[model samples]
Target: MTLEISRLLELTTWRVFDVADDGRVLAGCDESGSVQLVELAEGGCTELTALAGAVVGRYLPGERAVVVQHDSDGDERGQLSLLRLDDRRSRPAPLSELEPLVRDSEHVHRLLDVLPGRIVYATNRRNGVDFDVVIRSVTTGEEHVVHDGGGMVAEVAISPDSRFAAITVPATKPLSDQVLVADTMPETGADQLRELTDRDLAARHLHPGWQPGGLVVTTDAGRDRTGVARLDPRTGGHHWLVTSDEHDLSGRLSPNGRTLLVLTAVDGAHRAALHEAATGEHVVDIALPSGGWCGYPLPEPVWSPDSRFAALSFSSPSTPGDVLLVDTATGTCTPLTSSAAQLAEETLVEPTVHRVPARDGEQIPCFRYAPAAPDGSAVLLIHGGPESQSVRSFHPLVQAMVSRGHTVLVPNVRGSTGYGKRWYSADDARNRLESVQDLADLHRWLPSVGLDPSRAALWGGSYGGYMVLAGLAFQPELWAAGVDVVGISSLVTFLENTAPYRRAHREREYGSLIADADFLREASPLNRASAIAAPLFVLHGANDPRVPLTEAEQIVEAVRANGVAYEFHVYPDEGHGLAKRANRLDAYPKALAFLSRHLG
Candidate 1:
């Protein structure tokens, strides 16, 4: 059944951000992309605040107050705000007014943990480039820097006893980074920080969280595949807690530090497990609902204070995301919200996973969704983040196109995560265009699945958007139409104009502009705009900071100058992607209409 754009928009999407200590309330964003506090008993949600940008909130331990992270114009220089649930006031006050400890600068601050009378966080406020672990008092509003060093600080985990903070420093090589445990004493300095793991310098060690005896982290340190391990903060010794043949394995310790919730990526799908934290013995293998894998940032299963139930957000090919409460002991799952119940009931296409061979003999993983009725047309939906993978997540655009009888293929091309460190970085720098070649291979492989090559369209956002532009330019005769959503048109321009704090990270992944300028220009779609033979649709947000609006404007100008059939759109309030429901409702239908007009 073809669902209307309005019905797709009406689907209330929810994410389980944080569960209250008593497990009575959950905090997340509602359908409108606004911060909301949800009551577990009544399944009712209260809209807390409506900001112009995206916001992620976490509840302070044992308190009704929440710490929210938001940025201005999607620059990603996030700031933490405090909102009191007990306040009878009309709206929660700003962070600058409520918490004097936080600065209103272009710095990123993330709440780590809330202790008895203190709140621990990590911010780049110290240098505006590298993050430092900071602990601030809840009542006095005084803050202290616990760890400030050279490398970028990723995740910070505070011990239950409030004695030490475990911080993960990501390196170019996923495994070679270091996890340091710093004493949270009043006058702690850089000298007080002790490296918990001997740097492998080649393997990936990430997602550090505190367990009862030591630190639990995801690492591929002596193993071919990434797995969960326990590290001794005192001796710098560690042992693998869970290992699998799968490429990615990550886990989180429950609130009571007794149960460990483990998630592994087998091929591209996720398999969850519950393990005993002390002995690392498997308790029960979780049966995830048939849909997509849990959404990214991979919702760390929020455990009830009693450790009986865990809350997380799950989405699939057919349904939008919703919060689910899983019985940790029984392995039974219950839906906490009915956000996607109706959509799940709809006759949506269930995607079949396929491993298509690339030009270079490498196997490229893809999910293909074919409409029941034949339309002799297809669309290639690429994922962004040369580092991100396209999982079985609920995709409204894909569903809409499929419902209209367009076969959709979502490929996890080279450089996508969840495929091990080596595979994840395969297309870095000069090797990037090989991913586009993979797309070309996808075009050749389409007919094997009963798709028409002549009527094919390419659509993507962010990095995927770059792929669409590249496909149209390089393989000019391959595609009938193309859509770029907030995608980068020029690699050189994107690196030069992206936010200062993000420039270094992007350079590491995409190649240094100073060193690889010529290569970047050659690889950019803007440079090859004259080669584009297909009709193109470009959509972007004016306030985007990552792939700045200029990325879209320059390409649109080039495409129009070339006299190619093209359409352009910009959302004034949106930062990166269309996070707001109203904008999506307007954009998705227009995109589908454009595809229909051209591809059909």
Candidate 2:
């Protein structure tokens, strides 16, 4: 039953982005750009007709969600708008009969907050007041910015009491810099006044919130910048509420100050250990099926009203997300949702662990899936985030490979999160080479576990793509083929060409481009394409906001010039992921054919 290229596309989901306040009520803007709300109230029904074309931003109360909608026209985002039920019994009504906002091209709406009674919130992002505080009084329909700062208004936060507002900024751009805070919309604006700074600029920190008495934050305070602390909002004093010998203490107080949770790395993935809020004491550590939990835990675990259980959605790279309810009293984990249905009829081959040793002797942890088929070959699947993990999961992609007689191995190399902050911080400016070598070791080490060494190939997107090139460059014969899906060819060019929004975060994860430019160049795959050993396949989405198309093009150009065997595919309508069904079906089979030709 060989499937045609066109048939694969038909099986893919042509799902659009459905935005809802919570997970329950869903609404979608179809290709025509009309916002149609899903009707689950009357029955499992969906209507074809409703509201205007393309919402830049839409909010429905009880449906309580506010998301930044992507703009179609220019670089500018749109004006913030609120939609709600007239009486909580009927369909959502636009806050004002006035037309949905069409933001002037010059002004882009970056922040939005929705309040009751059409009291929509906005940040005048263009002005230094990026944190626009447009408070619409219920009695009067007037609107305005409350606390107009002179610098960029990064974000706006409303207190639970609904009586207070605050604006936050990075203080200044480079992540090592201090965090700045200012209060917004006060009765007098005096009691709300406070400024906080730090002298130990090297210490890691994050400004979580400001409570009635002071500010509560998570930071690597005493333990190499690896613990959470509560700080005096005015005086800049701080102390850790919970501290561990290992620097994994995280999760902070919620808006209401009722609950707190911390994620600590254990043997596998990370264990989400809960804490009691009133006194900040250890309550229970959540468990996963084979052992460790998955995904990055939240600032606060989902809590039941009766304080009985906390809900968490977890997955490993081998596992997709499965919601779980943990009993606070007994610390027993219960799956709220059943395990993922067998993927495409493949047996659920659980992943096993192995440590890939780097040149530096630091071990890289990996999850390897043994194929049920005796095809006598393995496939190495790498993850992007260099900062994220594969997690335990029932991923369809992995299943597809396993069903096709391939063993898949995902290595959580240096810079992966949930291993503790420092392990993640290890892949900074001076250490990119270490991360690259980790993958090379995995390709060399696969056969010790019964995985055939000669037929292995490297597959990844984004940083994972970067891994493919790095592997080919470092150990050409180690892998039979390579697939670089939107990977960076030159780290230097990636930094130089990245958009303004990514500059700050990238600086935190990577070193300052100005200071460590040489490091980026030294580790770049373009520099070593001459040494590449395998046939390569590359793909890029035209509209990707994260890794731009230039990354793929540069690598392809270099690979071609080097006379390396390769094929390149481009999709015009996709972003970072294959959102459209047509594009994925076209890409995967093309990739499969390319791999099949070379790997054999």
lDDT for 201 (candidate 1)? 58
The sequence of per-residue lDDT tens digits that candidate 2 reaches over residues 1-600 is: 232434323321111222232232233322232333332222433432233323333343334333323333222334544333333444343334323433444455553444444343444445522444456543355665565544434445455565555444443323332444444445554654445655335444553654565555566644543566666666767756776775356564544465566666553456677675545688776676654555442112344323455555555543444455566567787664433432364245677777777667778878877765547677788788776666655455665666566778877888775455566767766777777777767766766777678898989988888888888887776878999888888787787776555554566556678888777778888888788868889988776666778988877887788787889888776666564555666788888778768666
lDDT of 1: 0.77
Instruction: Evaluate model 1: give its TM-score.
Output: 0.92
Off by over 4 Å in 1: 33-35, 73-75, 87-106, 174-177, 186-190, 197-200
Worst 10 residues of 1 by lDDT: 92-101
Estimated TM-score for each candidate: 0.92, 0.76
**Each candidate's root-mean-square deviation in Å?**
2.8, 5.9
Off by over 4 Å in 2: 1-156, 161-179, 186-213, 224-228, 246-249, 262-274, 283-293, 296-312, 316-319, 322-346, 374-376
Cα-based lDDT for every prediction? 0.77, 0.58
Q: Write the per-residue lDDT of candidate 1 for residues 389-493, one digit (tens) a residue.
A: 888877778888888989999888888888877777688889889899888899999888888899999999999999999999888989999999999999999
What value does the lDDT take at residue 532 in candidate 2? 82
